[model samples]
Target: MAKKKFIVSALAGILVLGGIGVAAPRHAAAEPVSGGEITYGTQTDPVNWNPHQNNQANAFLYLRNIFDTLLEKTENGDFVPSLAESYSVSDDGTVYTFRLRDGVTFHDGEKLDAAAVKLNLDKANETPYSIYAFPNYDSATVVDDRTVEVRLKKPDASFLDSIAYIGWGIISPKSLTEHLNDLPSGGQNLAGTGPFRISSYQKGAQVVLESFDDYNWAPETKAHQGKAYLDKVTYRFLAEPSSRVGALPAQVDVIEGISALDVSKFKDRDGFVYLSNDANGDTFKLSLNAFLSPLDDVRVRQALRDGFDLDALVKSLYRGEIRRAWSHTSPVSPFYDKSLEGAWGNNVENANKLLDEAGWTERDSEGFRVKDGKRLSVRVLYPTQLDREQRSTLLQGISQQLKQNIGLEFIVDLTPSSTYLKEVASGAVHIYPSTWLHSDVRKSLNGLSNGGALATDNKADPSIQPLKDLAAEALATSDNAQRIKIFHELQRKAVIDDVTYIPLLVQAYQIAASNKVNGLGFINQIGSPEGVYDVWVAK
Candidate 1:
């Protein structure tokens, strides 16, 4: 019954996941005790504090408590009001009206109003970080003190969904002028309207967030009216999965997901409990970075993508726990296009022809192709913390496929967590793999799949321009039926024509905590660690 999906109404402004509302549970209903600091162990440290720029799935471990979105999305894809009291869209769908809560305030003394919404929306649309936020947005108009009328260039049905899920919760009007783009790690210097305040941060080590005493505007679904029970929430970055699991029951109160190999052992452990949910987002993908040379050549990117085997890797490493992804969007998403089931397959003959046609006709004594004095060599880089057998074997297979069949040298490089992003962003690495944790179908329009100058997958390929336009078309058209057509058109281009982004497998986030921890659950946004405000010490 939970799997059934009904057609979404284009004019409807509300989101109802599984046809029900997830009432934000209260502390009194949960195990009751005064308070205790929750030390959370995470896989990696966030590089940026700016929500628009921070793409890591674990970034929410800190930011969720510090910020609140305008609306909440249930795990089943329903939308509920959050920061904004209620919202509605015009018949044409170009204008959206959101009514603000009566007395909401940022951590700073600034008041929350329509002006704050407009300022943040305007800033997000301009920044490269806000790739999916206000995607087709034109301008924001403050209708009144509590009302905001957002005007879009075209009609869009999912614009509210984008707002309901942006990591950049409306910032303090004060912080906009002061902390704009200068925010450091954990966003300790930034101000938000959530139930927690960033108290301290030690850069790559840990971030401490103290509860906001004056916070009472928690969404109506929330069980508590004001002030969180826990006094402090500390997120400690432990890159090693084993290190995080070891910290349990003592050093840390909760640990984010265990290795697949260790899942059974932790399942029945008396002092601990396991929690997991299948993510409705992008799975692990070997981003075919076309910006780098050799790979900058579209045929080479397509050849490499076609030659590798992703199903074998998923079957070998995941053991049926996760399935190989076909489209850039998750299978769980409504926009996912399944016709591309076998669009990319093992094709050594096609791979060889592509290289030969690209004028890599000369072979060195080592049997490697060379054109214009440059060897057909590519480097693969991945974070050390992400080095699981599944990833390790996948890289090895990618290397073997390119080297043995086509004489392309695939050098595998291990990058430390601290400098991984810098190395990937330096444009030196040809192949890098990561996961996208967005619930919105617009995941294809951001980062690697964006296919723009800022996107890693772009390499002056004029073909991607049309797909980008199609993304805007799909986003702006209010009709879900029309969107399905446009979305498939974009997926067809991405999979068969471009082959720039390779979707590997669907994955889940496992949140585990001490048995004493209570009221930890999903938030209405993407990523892990949901509503921390409801969590409290058990008596």
Candidate 2:
């Protein structure tokens, strides 16, 4: 199968704002023999097939198949047209006008027009689910049957970034109006203009998707775009890592959540195709709760930031599978600041000086720092999973190092995901490891210190206001050059100066498919697999 490249052109996108018509997408006709099924295995079941209400990684595995975003994000981070033929932004950047493509239909046989776009956006904005990260979008107004005008409160240059976001994909206006703010259950209400529609879904079991015969609108980033080649695609929820890896070449055509050992085992092998992409949403970091006693002091937080050998942490946890990373965004993000590397990187001697200067001078018999009858110890709450042993091993090394250098005691408390939120909300646990997955890095950076963890996280700190102001200015401006500057400066100030959060490494999402599968692809900024839409088995 050849690569599918059916997106609207950038030059045409520019010309579109000036009232020039954009060219049609180049579709690749599939071979006459199109009837086949793609059965794949994933780690988790879709929380809900609805994207607006869900934010899990595996959820997209289902949502993406049933829905299509207005634009398609490429591997290189460019946004091209999908549901929308071409869209143009107002000069002030507050208004976004989209020209709908002709002949596109949703799963329910409803035509995707300006009304559909308005309905989906309006519904998504009102969903009570807390994880939804669409920008502060105001409204979507229908200019004409084929055109829609979306207005934002302010200029968000990253607005185009989330256009291809999961759940932000346009839905059928009729289905939404019928449901009217009440979420339909068990994926029953799922409707989109994607190439496939939900055939059958049993919660926590299997989801079957059949290709939409009338489906034709696909962003140019895909390969062979008339409709998905496979007649049906079955996504089986295989939770165990061993089961996921074992079924790879035979039982399942594609599998994810493969263990690190299996990734190496199949990397050079001929029968398996391993695909790894960096996730943009979150970073693996020890969030220093600024409200915590010792961490409340900026000097102490800076000391801890300087003390930890982050490269060691990365090596221990990921075992060389991923690299040490900096910044709130992935390296591939447009606003990513590459210069932030090693600028706030780990150190040992500087850490001791800061701690000593902060008046934690007394050392106890156990060689741990003591001040005012308090031990220099911190508790870190983390989820107990496959990496618990690895994290324990790394913490042991850190314990030895911190004890010897700064006389600090580091305690790691493993918790389950069920109780994880309870512990975090309790505010008793200040330090913990968590990932923040998102599409736009601008949103990521601004809210990085505002919520969750902070070393000395005072949102109203006059000391940190300049950095926050710079970020606020960065978000308002649509200029990439200015964004790059502001993002870099924000990284330097927050991580290095404020010691807010230490970005250990960029998270890697692994997808392994059997040799039989072809044209498995990815979308969104984080690079998760788009769907089995373009995949076909060689029969």
Candidate 3:
């Protein structure tokens, strides 16, 4: 269930992890010790445990530590062997062969084998909510106990990049039938081959992971190739910034995505380390439901895009901490189109003219545009947990600006993650805001074009078929140059020609860790924090 971001809320909750938050006795620094425990404060709990069925960034961020994919992507965008010791693709690119690592075992003690690989791939294809769909994926065959072959219906150049996603994370085959629905609760059913195992899960409160003592297989790129140094990692769900930062070196050893205001507190602090990275993924943007009245018209959509002053709104909300985005892809990505930067801006007069031309010239007593006795109003659907930063304030400002500038009413609808998914699927929302995860350009197009995950859940109009075809062409070819060209045209059609989305701002990941916490690194090129594999307390 790929979902949207959050809305405004008050900060009133705090977590109490027993025996955590107590400072250990300090000593002189020496070699990295192997047995220690640390508590991590993160934002959201996993909504679903089935990797293929959930696309929430927070869920994958945590699961990356619990599961191992066939291959691991390096920080420099190179692939290295993880579960699969080696892999090769055929010349035509329709077939792939993987040699599973020897002596590897899932947490449940099931030996890693070719049969497990085939079972995972086949199950992903059968799941409806799987975000990474290999339309060309045909079938998988077990060549031997440690060898497997995957045949595709057609050539897909992006297959390797797509398979590296944690959503394809291999699990014990028996759990598929035994504990399919309850994986979210995470006990013995949450079986993965990674360095950590779920010791316990406390729903929305916390999840405790203990190091797998027998784990030794690590990606070739990593220097450490043994069990996780930390004995235990307790992830406390702290959605509020005040509670997370307040825990600090006392209650939590690491806190994720601290507010920009909290960065100043760590700069001069002696025992803290603050790390920041320019995230590589989808920009925070809004998708308009074309099935709805007024929004179905291109003129109305264009008016909405140019109606608000995004530059001013971003400055006021982020306060120079984050950058404004003008395209669908992040500026950090090679596929980003610099030409779209100045192609559009805040043009109040032009927005008004466009709305007038769309037959919304009449104004009601509330100053909202009216046509056929109906006022022009849109409801923006957003989740509730994302208020950790200033996201709520940012959205409210945009709504107010639209009302003042174009005589259009923008209503902010804040709901829980469960309700948000249902509203998005019902095709009843007028506007949906989201920021998704994508390491490849084709994945970005999946959310922008018709029938994409981020696109409105409605029947695709015949006119948008060409846009969808461009997305398919980008994925079918492996040539980097040809793929780049296709992505440019696809973005132009979606943003400039069709007015499908309003590009917002680039996402920045900020994390703070105690000086005692060592060997902290990101999981992928997109830079989500790796689970406590190599991290150790320096004492």
Listed in order, each prediction's TM-score against the native is 0.82, 0.84, 0.91
Clashes of each: 7, 11, 2
In candidate 3, what are the lDDT values of residues 1-539, reduced to their tens digit?
22111111101111000001111112224577889899999888877776777676666657877889987665555566889887776656677788888999999898889999998888777747466667778999999999998888987655666567787888888777688777756776889898888898888899899999889998865547899888999999988888899998889999887777778887557898777666677888887777676788888888888999999988876777788888877777767778898888698899999998999989999899999999998888888865446777778898899999999898988888768877888777888887876575556766666733434545476766777787777766555666667777767766777777788878777778898887765555465555668788986
Whichever of 1 and 2 has more lDDT, that candidate is 1
Model 1 lDDT at residue 123 = 75
lDDT of 2: 0.68
Whole-structure CA lDDT of model 3? 0.75
Which stretches of model 2 miss by more than 4 angstroms?
1-7, 10-33, 127-130, 133-136, 174-185, 344-346, 362-368, 383-409, 413-429, 448-463
Q: Lowest lDDT 10-mer window, candidate 2?
A: 15-24
Clashing pairs in 1: 15-78, 15-79, 16-78, 16-79, 17-78, 24-221, 155-476
Candidate ordering by TM-score (highest first): 3, 2, 1
Candidate 1 lDDT, tens digit per residue, 1-539?
01112222222322221112222222123445657778988776676777666666667656677888777666445656777877776656566777888888889878999999888888777756564455568998999999887788876545655676646567787777777766645455588898998898887788888999888877654656788989998888887778887888689988775767666656678767777655556667767665667877888877777776667766776666557778766666666788989867678789889989998989888888999988999777787766643576677777876777888988888888778778766666777776767665556554423552224534446756666677666565545677777877776666667665777767566677888887776553453557588788786
How many angstroms is residue 150 displaced in model 2 relative to the true structure, after the best TM-score fit?
1.3
Off by over 4 Å in 1: 1-34, 128-135, 186-188, 220-225, 289-302, 347-374, 381-393, 413-429, 432-434, 445-466
